[model samples]
Target chain A: MTEAVAIENLSVTFTGGSKPVRAVDGVSLSLGQGEVLALLGESGSGKSVTLRSLLRLHPPKRSRMTGSIRVAGRDVLELSPGELADFRGGVVSMIFQEPMLALDPVYTVGAQITEAIRRHEKISAADARKRALALFERVRIPSPDRRLDAYPHEMSGGMRQRAMIALALACRPSVLLADEPTTALDATVQIQILLLLRELQRELGLSIIFVTHDIGVAVEIADRIAVMYAGRVVESGSVRDVIRGPRHPYTRGLLASRVERAQKGDRLETIPGSPPDLTALPPGCAFAPRCSLAAPQCREIVPPLAEVGPAHTAACIRVAETV
Target chain B: MIIGEPAHLPDGPDRGGPAQPLLSVRDLVKHFPVKGKGLFGKGAVVRAVDGVSFDIRKGETLGVVGESGCGKSTTARLLMHLIKADSGEMVFDGEKVGADLDLTAYRRQVQMVFQDSYASLNPRLTIEESIAYGPQVHGVSAAKARAKAHDLLARVGLEPGRFAGRYPHELSGGQRQRINIARALALEPRLVILDEAVSALDKSVEAQVLNLLQDLKDEFGLTYVFISHDLNVVKFIVDRVMVMYLGKVAEIGEGPAVFGAPRHPYTAALLASMPKMDPDARSAEAPLTGDPPNPINPPSGCRFHTRCALAEPVCSVQEPPLAAMEGLQEAACLMALPGSGHSRAPAPVEAAA
Candidate 1:
């Protein structure tokens, strides 16, 4: 399989503040065509920052970014303004958590989708509108003709999300960047959306980077999962390995903290400390303060993400000692 | 009249009486008027909570699970009397709640904790003062209230010395939530309404707060109306569950039974929709099809027919009453009832290893 997206030594630092905050540390990731990778983390973990960097969504004046990003065999950072605009929706598209906010309320859903298609390809208005209708039907919107004229406010949350996905797919991008697309939706609607995404990915063979804080959501969607903490990828592996038999203490702590794993009336095992401040991180592993298996060596030297098992890597020195 | 839990109702032979429920809501309804299109035009009504009813047993946690605009929060607000119900009866400890009800006595017995930690508490008031303020208004002396607040703060695991004097802005989300819990319990309420109380906290912090709530319930003999969209949390903490769909009760039963063998299509769909924690277990198909019909003009009869996969022609025209299923489970669906030709055998609860 060809590599759809590859990132090497990516770092993002906000220099506008008095103390420069490094949001994304030296992180590296790669996703093959048609593969879904879930960047899982809590707030301030840089999972979102890492995904946003692919599109260069940060303000260049306030943020200093150092990275080599290759998507669809093109270097992302080296793209000119015109090329970047073409690359965004033509080669890659994004969907957000709140589709209503992402969608323009003033215009009809069809108008926005047609505009996206027209922006990427030189087409007549009628042709663009026809393509937009096809995309809407492809995303399973009922009464495609009627829905094309409905504004964002007129549609329900689930319908609005479907419209967003249709808009994202309007340009037929190979890579999709979804940042918590289902986070704000209800559970039933979330499942519907997740299923729709999985179907679209398989049918279209699109490489997707799904960012979420919910581990269960990650398990449902991703083939491989990358656990982020304090701007670093602490663990990277297949979803089954990362969830059932996690080698990293942080990953283990996260799985153990779930209420489903514990019996009623039992005290849930917690990580025992707050997430580290990215601006004032500790010397070694940022998770060391909360890891129950942390030792003197863990606090002194940073543990590189090393292979613990076949196709699984964990950034913990004590991975061997764990079962 | 109290809609008694007939299926799960405890024996009444000993005292010649089944103990009255801690709180009972009968056909409660509340609607807000939408803004008119023109100055002289009449406003439309949004049926936020339409004829909802339930009962909370003493010392029991009744979990209310629903999607957005499903009236879970509105039910909580109604229980706290934060908003007046347009029509229906509420009985608290056998006393009717109404305009003539003693407001102070009612406030002393029921308290609520909101979801947003940063917005819920007063920024100007210190943690201790905020917790003490509720009790002070209910006739407790300021000094006594402060002392009680300090003791309560320690009970919720916040150190009085470290947290009591700090303002709301100084504390983290988890700490502020703990303070909120302390404030809710300051009046020693019998029933505490928690509306998405732990939804804002991180997983670890949420676990800690949930455990704390469990311990506090046992110690204080308190009942909780736990309202949240998270099914997993509700399954872990609540003994019984009530599933609401578009301001109507879809199903209600013991947690294990309700989750294990959901009778209502909506309940089953909700259970199937939860992203399974185990990656190996993936749902075969989308259980539900569409968004819930707009509540402003909800579906003619059954509000869930628009989304339910098993919805028949009759489902959209005739409303199904909440009928008994298996054991203590009750579901409002014609498909699950006998003589509907769709009555399937109930799925048994999986035995834990």
Candidate 2:
């Protein structure tokens, strides 16, 4: 299978007057065609920064990014301003967390979708309108003809999300980077959006990099999962392996802390302490202070991503001995 | 599921003690006039909180679950009297509460933790000053208020010495929420309304905050009206659960009864739609069709009848009242009503394709 997207040693730093904040440390990841990969993390875990880096969407004036980001056989960093704009909506499309903000309030849904189509393809207005309606139908938007005339503010949260998805898929991009696409939606709508994404991925053979803070959502959609913390991928594996039996303490803590399995009276197992500050991360393992099973070796040296089993890896010093 | 588990009822007035309920709401209705003006000039009313009634026992958590615009948040605001109800009776501790009731005294006893912590907290005020504001308004000495603020910060898991002087922008989302929680507790309010308190947080951070809430509930003997859009979180924290749709209570029951065996079709659909953390337990039911109806002229019968799959002709004509079921369970659906012919054989309607 061809690699749909490959990122190598990507690092993002926000430089100010004195000390620069490393928002994302050196990290490498790859996605195959039709593959769904979930980047799971808490706030400030650098998942959003990594996703923003894919299309050079980060603030360039303050953000300093290094390393190669290859999407659809093209180096994303090497593209010129005009080339980047053409590449953005054409090769790699993105659906943001808040659809209302991503969508133009003044423009009708049809107009936006048609603009997306017209930007990439030199089609007439009539042809673009037809394609927009078709895309709306593909996303299962009810009464596509009527919804095309509705503005973003006129639509419900779920409808707005569907429209956003329609816009992202409008240009038939090879890779879709969804940053918490369903976070603000209700549970039912979240499921609908997830199922739609999964269906579209199957039909279109588009690679997806899904970023979320909810593990349940990742389990429902992702083929592979990457658990990030501070600024690095702490663990990466197939969804089944990572969910069923996680090796990293952060992953284990996340699984154990989830309110999913507990009965009404069951006390939730909470991971004590908070996420480490990016500006002042601790020495060695960033999770050492909160890890219950932390050993002396964990505080002295940063662990490499050690493979525990086929397609399963964890960046922990005790990964070999823990399981 | 355990049947007739009294432990499910938190330490409230209705749980056999002589003390009265801390808050009792009857037929609560809050309607906000729609934005636009017309010849009828009054404009259509957004039935943010329709005819809903429930009681919050002292020192108990009453979880209200619904989607956005389902009136859960409106119900919270109504209980706090932050927004007045159009038509309803709010009785607190055996005393009938009116709009003219001295809000200052009531404000001291009722505190609210909002969803957007940053928006709720004053950017100009330091953490200590923010928390102290409530106590100061209640006529406490400046020294005492500052002391209470420090105590509240520690109670909500923030270090007072380190965080007291910091501004809202300096803290993380979770830390800001903790400050919000601390500010709510500053006055030692009897009832706390947590409106989607942990929804904006990461799952891990949410869990920690939930644990903190449970601890505080036990230690302070606090009564909570926990409102949220997430059912899974509600299931984990609440003792009794109320399912709302279109500004009405669709179902009300003990946590296990409501979650394990939902009576109303709307409740069943909502339960089915929730994604199970366990990958093997996925449901095959299609997601509910159509958005909730407009609240201005809500469906004639049951507010949910428009979207309800099992809604019959009667559901579109006669509004079903919230009535009790077999055990600690209540649903306001014609199908769940007694002598409705549909309740005779529960399995038939539920089991049929």
Candidate 3:
């Protein structure tokens, strides 16, 4: 299978803070063409940082990035200003968690989408606008034509997200990075957005990297799952394999704690401690403090991703014997 | 009228008259006026909560679930009397809240925990001070309140020695929430309203807090009005579930009944909308379409008709009243009633039989 996107030993350090925070540490991930990968983690998990890195969305002076990012045959780190501009929307585009903040407040949603399309391709204004309307319709925004003229503030939360998705897909990019796209939405509306994204990913043959803290959402859309803890992908495999039989202790703890897994009135299984601070991370595994199966070795040395099953890997020494 | 829970109602029936509910709310309404677009134009009212009513039995956690603008949070606020209702009657422990129960006294017995833990706490005040502030205002001596704060802090799993001197900014999200829970219990309130309290925490932390909450409830014999949007959490924690849509109660009953066999179309759609744990059983289509109609001018008759899949012409013509179904649950749906003019409804004779 062709690799649509790849990252080798990517590490992002935000130097602007009191201490240089290693937001993402030694993370390597790859995405196949027309596949969906869910990067699952809580806040400060570096899931968002990794996704933003794909677009070089971070400020260069404030943050130092050491990695090789290759997407659609272009080295992302090597792209010129002009090339990066085109590559952002033409090769890969992103939709954020809050559309209200992500979208420009002054411009109409239709105008922004049209501008995106026209910038990527040498299309006429009329043609670009027609395409924008089609994209809105494709995303199932009710009254597409009327809504196209509406400003970002005029739409509801769910509608704004739909508009955001339409804008992201304006240039027909091969990759779509969604960061908690449906987290702000209602359950009913959240399901709608998830289904819409899944449908669009299939129809467009788009390789999507969806980041969310909600495990159920990850299960709903991703063909593959990568569970991140304190900037590292602790476990990854096919969604079926990972959800059904998670090897990493953290993954096991997360799946077990879900309210869906237990009967009413039963106490939910909980991970004992909290996520580590990135700035002053422990010497070894970041999740060691929270992990139930952590041993002396776990706190002494960082665990590398090791194969446990076919196309499955876990970053824990304790899991080796069990696997 | 109190909606009694016949099956799961508390043990030991009253020796006197019929047992009174812990809290009974009737026809609660609250509307906020929206200024007109033009200065001279007529104003509009946002129907935040319209004629919502329910009963909170003793020693029970009643869960309210809904999307945004469904009036769940507003109902929580109204229950706490944080925001005065435009028109409603609230009865607490058989005494009318305003008529018999003094508002100040009532405030001491009911407390609320908001979603934003940090904002809820005073940054300038220490953890012990925050927790002790409540009791101090209610006439507890400073020394006694501080001692009680330490006790409550220990109960919430935060060591008083380590956490009492810390401010809100010094704690993590989970830790801060625990502090908030401790502060809520500082008043030794009978009823605690948790409005999206655990919604902000991480899944792992959320589970820990949930467990802590259950333990606290058992220890204090506290009743809770747990409001949240997460259906799975609500289903697991709440003894009774209330499903709301567009400022109206769509369904309310025993937790399992409401979740497993919903009587209202909106309730059924909501249950269907929850993302399943099993990846193989993903929902093929969205159960409901379109955002809920603007609350300022909700859909006529049935507010949910615009988004409800099973809505009929009668749904737009006449509103369905919340009434007991043939089964254990109570639903506000035309079809749930045999003679409610819905095509799919069972015949009156069949239902009667």
Candidate 4:
């Protein structure tokens, strides 16, 4: 099976601050066709930055990026301006946390979707409109015709999100990049979106990179989970292995701290201390201070991504077994 | 104030009783006028809290869960008297709050902790000053209030020697929230309305804060009106859960009952939609879809009928009352109401299908 997306030792640093902030340290990830990979992290964990880098959506002047990103057999980092434009929506599309901001407020949803279709393909306005309607129907938007005429503000949060998904799917991209698409939605509405995405991915065979802060959301959607802490991928494994038995201390701490795991009246086991500042990370493990089983050597040497089980890798020194 | 009766009554016992709840809200309604559009013609009414009613039993946390614009926050504001209700009755400890009611005394007994500690705390005030300010305003001596503030600071796990003199901005999100909790407790409030108090924190920090909240509740015997959008957090903290949709109660039951076997379709959908951390527990289907209807021109009969998967014709024409369920629970759904006639309908289809 062909790998739909491959990221090799990717790193991103922002130079605008007084001290250059290493937002994303060396990280590598890959997803096969029709696979869903969830990049899980909290605020400032660089999950969003990694996702945006697939389309090179960062400012070029103030920030520096290293390593290679290949999506759909194309070297994303080496694309020309025109090629990059063609690759963005035509090859890989993205939905965002806030649809209101992503959607153009002044235009009707129909015009926006049709415009995206026309920009990438040689199609008449009427044909684009027809395609837009079909896309809306595909995303299961109710009252598709009326919703097409609605503005971003006129539609509710869930409707706007569906419209955003419809817009992203207008180009029929091979890989769908969703950045917390359901974060702003209600639980009932969010599940609807999640299920829709999973169904669409299956039908269309589109690889997906979903970024979110919630572990539960990742477990619900992802085929593989990559737990990001600070700037790096601390743990990468199948969802069952990661959730059932996380090898990394950070992943374990996150699971233990989940409210669902704790019974009533029991104190939640927490990883003490805050996330490290990106501008000046510690010499060794960024999470060592909070890790319960951190050895003295963990402070002097950064642990590599060592395999702990079949198809499982954890960046922790405590793991003793390998596949 | 009634002239024939005494002006004051002794405070009721601090625990649950069959006769009365610590706080009783009946038919609470609040409407905010939509601006500018009204200048041209008739203004729209944002029905924030539309005839919502519930009771907070002593020492029990009553959670209000909902989406944005669902009136959960508005209900908290109404209880705090920060905003006056258009119409309703709030009876606290057998005394109905009215114009003649002692507002100061009522406020002292019922306090609120807000979500944004940054906005709630005065930037200029030190941690100790902010905590002590409430008691000082309530006629406690300055020195005694300061001593109480120090004690509370210690109780919240913030070392007063280091934190009491620091400003709010200097503290982390978790520490600031602890101070907020301590300040609410300083008033010796019997009821604490925590509105999304820990929603902004990270998951680990949220867990720590939740544990602290449980500890404080036990120590202070505080009855909390915990309003949050995060159902998982609500499940862990609150004793009774009240699921709200479009400014109305969809279901009210004990935590496990509401989460496990929800009676209302909306409640069931919300519970089913929750993303379980365990991969093996993947949801079979999306139970329901669509955004809640506009609150200004909410759907008739049942506000949730517009998006409900089990909605029947009667649900669009006749509203369902809060009918009793199997346990000490109630749900406002035509399917759950015995005489609604839709109770015998075929199984509802999944929205995702």
Candidate 5:
């Protein structure tokens, strides 16, 4: 499969007062065509920053990004202002966590979708409208004809999300970046949206970068998983291998912390310490303070991603020695 | 009207001993009128907690689980009397609750833990002051309240020396939530209503709080009305469960029984919808289809009929009453009834390996 999106040695740093805070440390990842990659992490794990940086949406003056990001054979970071604007929605599209905030309340859903389509493609207004309605129907919005006239506020949360997905797919971008797409939705609605995404991915052959804090969501949708901590990918592998037998201590801690997995009468095993503050990270492995398998060496030097098995890698000093 | 010989009800668990329950609620309704008028030219009621009724035992955790707008939070508010119910009967400890009901006395016995830790606590007030507020209001002396607050803080696993003087803004989310729990316990309330208490927390933090709640319940002999949207958490914390849809109870039973063998289609669907943490245990059940019906003009007969997988013609024609099955299970669904064609067989208990 062709690489739909690729990032090499990406690093983002912000200058605050005297010290420079590295929000996203040196990282590298690639998504194949029609593949879904889950960027799993907690709130301030820099998953959002990494995703934003890929599209060149970060604040340029305050934040400095050093990386090579290629999307559909186009160097996203090197694109000129005119080319960036034309290439953004034409080759890659993004869907945020909150659909209502992303959608325009003043305009009808159909009008907004048609406008998105027209921005990327040279089409008549009537043709765009026709295509928009078709897109809405494809996203499984019931009674597309009537829903096209409804505003974002008029639609239910699930319907609004579906409309958002339709809008993102308006130009049929090869790469779709969805950041916490199902977090705001109900459990049932989340399942529906996930299934819809899977269906669309297969039909359109689109590569998706799905980011979420919930590990359950990542397990359900992602073909490959990349666990992020302290702005760096700690582990990366096929979902099956990573989930069944996680090599990283942080990943193991996360899996063990779930209430569902604990024995009926046993207490949940929580990771000892809190996530490290990005502003003042420790000298060595960021997760050393909280890691159960940490030794003196773990706190002295940072570990790079070491191959644990076929197509699986984890950044841990004890991966080979333990288990 | 003739006064009863004794208003106090029997405490024993018998079939039919007394009519008075430890806590009795009848036809509890709370409506928030919408501000703007539509084409109808009149404000509409939000129907937050419409006609909710359930009894709570002296020392039992009654878990309330529902989606965002299913009125779980509103029900908690009504029970706490934080807001007045539009119309209903609320009897606490066999005494009627009303405007004239001694709020200070009631507040001492029935405390609440809110969802948002940031908004619930006063930023200016220190942890000790916040926890002492309830005790002080109920006639405890300032010195006594301070001592009680210190003990409560310790009970929730926070070191009094380090955390008692810290303000709400200075604490982490988990620490703030511990203070919230400590404050709720300051008055030694018999019942504690935790409304989405741990929903906003991280998984590890949530687990810690839940374990703390369980430990406190055992130590203090406390009863909890645990309200939440996450069924897994509810199952972990509660002994008995109450599933709510729209503004009504969909199912009520022992936690294991209800979770292991759900009778109502809504209950089953909710269980199916929950993302299983263990990939091996993923259910083969079909996904729930369609959105929840609008509560403003909910489906006529059954509020869940629009999305229920086993919905029948009768479900849309008439509302099913909450009926008791054999043992300790009760469900508000025609299919769960004994005579109904869709009646499920008794679940076989798994033996210890």
Candidate 6:
């Protein structure tokens, strides 16, 4: 069986400024059908960049890409301009962190979803409206009929996000890209949306790539976890392995730095330094400067991902069991 | 537990008289009028904060938590005087604000650090200049202010020599937030209101900043009104926790009591809403459904009744008062008090429990 999404050595560099920023560097990832893979990282870690590359969403004038991306059996990188446009939303749809900014303010929520459905298929407006109402019901939006006519601004934050999910799913894409969809919401609202997504993913057998910096959210929704740092996948494994037995020094630091890891009134263990500059990352391991176990050799060579457990892989020579 | 009593402070430079609360707010209320709506316009007022009252003790971190539009930020802004309140009274160190202590003097005693570090600082100013500007405006000598800024820079773990001359744009988000903390401290404030100050940082960076804040609090004997939506962070740092819903305090108590055994249904639901860190223990069902209701003319009584799992008919008719419970905890729930007309309320004999 073919994978829902496959990426190989994806390198994306933004070249607008004098010094180019290698946003994503030699990152490879794959997701099976109906699997939920979380691209976990802090800001500037390039998780979002890798997700966007699959859709060819970057500005052509400023960004240069040099890697192959395949999604749902289509060669994303090889697709023509027009075909790329068709591939977007028709085969792969994405939901953003902020629904207020993502949804069209002028159009009613139902109108937007109906237009999205009509955009990919030759369905009548009436049928599309019916489909849109069904989607609203599917996402459990209150008062589906009244909510359909309400504009994005008229709805509350959580309501707006439900509409966003309805719109994203309107085209019936096999793969979904969720970029921190719950980060902007409160804990109560976040869990509701998360549960909704999990139910929908299972019900529809949809493959999903979720990008978020929040570990708890990742643990709640993702089956596989990929920890990114300095534009590389430092660790990737089942959620249990990554969270319970994090191998990468950066990933370990991230887990230890959380509030629950420290006793009350105790100083939280930190990574000691900020992320490396994307434009001027060190020649070897970018995290070596801040890593506690860094040795002389660790700074001179960039470690490759090696198997630690049956399914776990980490990019640190010291921690890699294969060595 | 009430919202009307005003405290009296003794006239002196010494802050926080022997048993006095560092700051006390009474009947704090703020209602932002909607566009094209007058003060008396039909349901025009967005009751962002309605009659919130609390006391801040010296040297303790008081956390303010709630969902968005729950009036957490509005309450902070009112405390900071960033926005005028419709009705309220504040007593700082037992002295009534505006009456006993002037606005400028009151402001000097209290400082605020916002979430957006870059937007809060002046773009043209260097790190040292930004920190020193507060003291300079308050009539401190320029050289002394600069000297203090350098000392604070070192204290916050930023080497003064390296960071002082750099502009805001040159520093990272974590570094800029440190500068904001330094700026807040330059005035020698007794109370600091950190409104989601660490929310924007990464886990690693947030840990570092939180440590810095704890150290600063100890060194300066600072009282903190730490407002955030992250319950884990709040449970870790604050001595006391206040849970707000629809601009009203639902629960306020010692940290352990509020988190371990909450009396209010809203508080219980909020605690349950936290996603467990363990992957195997993912919650099967959502804690509470539906978004927080709009602030405009919120539900008739007990603002949380609409979504609360344990809400009864009385919850929508009569608002529960903040009844004092054991362990110095207070909750505005009918179930916490005996014979409050709710079937699930504690028995009169069990009221002492």
lDDT of 1 by residue, B1-353 (tens): 12221211232211212377877899999998878673324676778899988888877899999889888998899888899999999887777776434666666678899999889999999999999887666666788888998999999999999888999998778889999999999878778999999998878689889988998999987889999999999988888999998888999999889988888888888888899887889765778778766667788767887876667777778787777765798888877655543435233334311
Across residues A1-323, which tens digit of lDDT does each residue of candidate 1 receive? 78999999899999989999999999999999999999999888999999999998999899988979999889998999899999988888999999988999899999999988888899999999999889989999999999999999988999999999999999999999999999888898899899999999999999999999998899999999999999999999999989988999988888888998877678888777678777789999898898889899999988999999888999999998776
DockQ of each: 0.66, 0.58, 0.82, 0.61, 0.44, 0.85
lDDT of 5 by residue, A264-320 (tens): 446778886567778889878999999878899999898999899998999998996
Give all candidate RMSDs, comma-separated: 5.8, 5.7, 4.3, 5.0, 5.3, 4.0
lDDT of 3 by residue, A146-198 (tens): 99999999999999999999999998899999999999998889999999999
Residue A128 miss distance in model 6 (angstroms)? 1.1
lDDT of 6 by residue, A234-253 (tens): 99999999998999989888
Report the backbone clash tally of model 4. Answer: 0
Docking band of candidate 4:
medium
Q: What is the interface RMSD of each candidate, in Å?
A: 1.1, 1.8, 0.8, 1.2, 2.4, 0.7
lDDT of 2 by residue, B1-353 (tens): 12222211232333335467788889998988877664235678888888898888777789999877789988988888888788989877765775534566566668899999899999999999999987676667788889888988998889899999999999988899999998888767778999999998878789889988988988877888889888888888988899998899999988889988998888888887777676666444446865566667777987887777776777777888887778789998877665554443244333222
As for DockQ, the candidate ahead, 2 or 5, is 2
Q: If candidate 4 were superposed on the true structure by all CA atoms, what would the RMSD be? A: 5.0
Candidate with the larger TM-score of 4 and 6: 6
lDDT of 4 by residue, B254-314 (tens): 9888887888888877777788766887886887756776788889998888878777788
In the range B1-353, model 3's lDDT, one tens digit per residue, is 12221211232322122467778999999998888673324677889999999999888999999889999999999999999999989988877898887787677778999999999999999999999998787767788889999999999999999999999998899999999999998877888999999999999999999999999999988889999999889999999989988888989999988888998888888888888878899889999887777788888887777877788899998888887865568998888767779897767866452
Clashes per candidate, residues 3 or more apart or on different chains: 0, 0, 0, 0, 0, 1
| Model 6: per-residue Cα lDDT at residue B83 | 93
Candidate 6 Cα deviation (angstroms), residue B184:
0.4
Candidate 6 clashing pairs? B9-B94
Which model, 2 or 3, shows the larger DockQ?
3
For lDDT, candidate 1 versus 3, the one ahead is 3
Candidate 4 chain B: 10-residue stretch with minimal lDDT: B1-10
Q: Give lDDT for model 4.
A: 0.87
lDDT of each: 0.87, 0.85, 0.90, 0.87, 0.82, 0.90
lDDT by residue for model 6 (B306-339), tens: 9988888998998888889888799998888788
Model 3 lDDT, full chain set: 0.90
Give each model a TM-score.
Answer: 0.93, 0.93, 0.96, 0.92, 0.92, 0.96
